[model samples]
Target: MSEPTGVLTLRLAGPLQSWGAASRFARRATERAPTKSGVLGLLAAAQGRDRSADLSDLAALRFAVRLDQPGTRVRDFQTAHHADTGKSMPVSERFYLSDAVFVAAVEGDRDLIGILHAAVRSPVYLPFLGRRSCPPSRPVDLRAHPSGLWKALEAEPWQASTWVQRSRARERRVELEVIADLSAGDGPGDAVRDQPLSFDPRHRRYGLRSVHSRAVTVANPLSAPRRAFVPTQHDPMGLLED
Candidate 1:
């Protein structure tokens, strides 16, 4: 089938989201910033796929995130207790947990929309904001542009405004205020469309509160296919090159 296109707006918020990175050792886990792989994995689960698929169609899709109330990173230690042997051992471990909100915007082919809709309704996989496995606070949909999306996001009656900041490494900080005001009637979609999906620091705080914006790309898994029983490296290249 020809490639499908659409946009996905996911709102992520919870007490803790665990995106592991550089974790090795038993009972050891490390939390890293959310990545395209982890987010896609969650989407695939909604589709009932336990394993990753070739979703290359999502590659060209634009990705962006707006973090609301960027939370601090915390690490905890774990120790082992032997019940039968009555022995105690100290074990060191590291991981990350944070309470923050995420707004993700994805734009792509129409087929992608159908998949997302189905995934939301009867998700083969559970949906999560970060790692909290929390159901989306609102329905996910495809809109014309960021303004349309902002409208939908604000429409939620329970929406609250807040200030947020994100650390770009451990040094610099970007600040902004975000407010829930979709009623202002942002112009037609075309004018704001194709804005290269960037986080606006000026609009950082939602109302008087601030939030963090973490943008990521969603890769398409179906763009390239390998020949039957061929060595992986020997597979032909550029079949999808336009």
Candidate 2:
């Protein structure tokens, strides 16, 4: 298979994005950065995959993002009162989720693009732009990028920003917009398919790491071009592997 090239843009913004860090209790929450695992979970949902699968395919892909702005952090305190005295008790520490927007771009094999398209079309689970509770304001299709991914995200026509800001006074966060371009090989067979690209283990923490902050054009360095993959009924999940 030949290397493919294209861009995958993700816009993350909402009143809350729970990226569990050191979560211990059923309702336990943590205050930390976004983790790669958490971001992958969102992607899996977009593809409709509820259970974990081999993410090796994504390992080869180059991921980058621009943090439009910083985010606000707030903690919700919980506590119980004395049973005999029935007095007010001290509040326990439960962190409220942070709010921010992320713009990400992925450039790799064309086969990867096909798989992503399929994931969005008939996701195994309810896909969300960032969090399950915060569904995308628009259909998450790259074709909707005539105005660019950043524009699409800003056009969500929802009050997500308002809610995010109102959650906490000290929660003053930043707003960022991203623009990415990708190029991959048009290879044959499934050689590039299901192969893991660069996968971020930190995604479960502070969201996807910001790689290559400065915008740079990507080039495909393959001499022999490969053919793109054609979908088959028996191989519905095969795309995810690529």
Best by TM-score: 1
Tens-digit lDDT track for model 1 on 1-242? 75544456666566656555334575445333444444555666677653434445443454444443455677677677888997887686655556655555555565775666567666765677545533444444323332333443333222112322212222132332332212234332212112112123343111111223322222222223334775566536668667
Please list the residue runs of candidate 1 whose C-alpha ends up more than 4 Å from where it truly belongs after superposition: 1-4, 26-33, 58-60, 79-92, 129-242
lDDT per residue (tens digit) for residues 97-151 in model 2: 4565544444456667567656766667765533354565434443223323334
Clashes of each: 46, 53
TM-score of 1: 0.49
Task: Score candidate 2 by TM-score against the native.
Answer: 0.47
lDDT, each prediction: 0.45, 0.46
On lDDT, the leading prediction is 2
RMSD values for the candidates in order, in angstroms, are: 23.3, 21.5
> Candidate 2 — which residues are off by over 4 angstroms?
21-34, 77-99, 128-242
RMSD of 2: 21.5
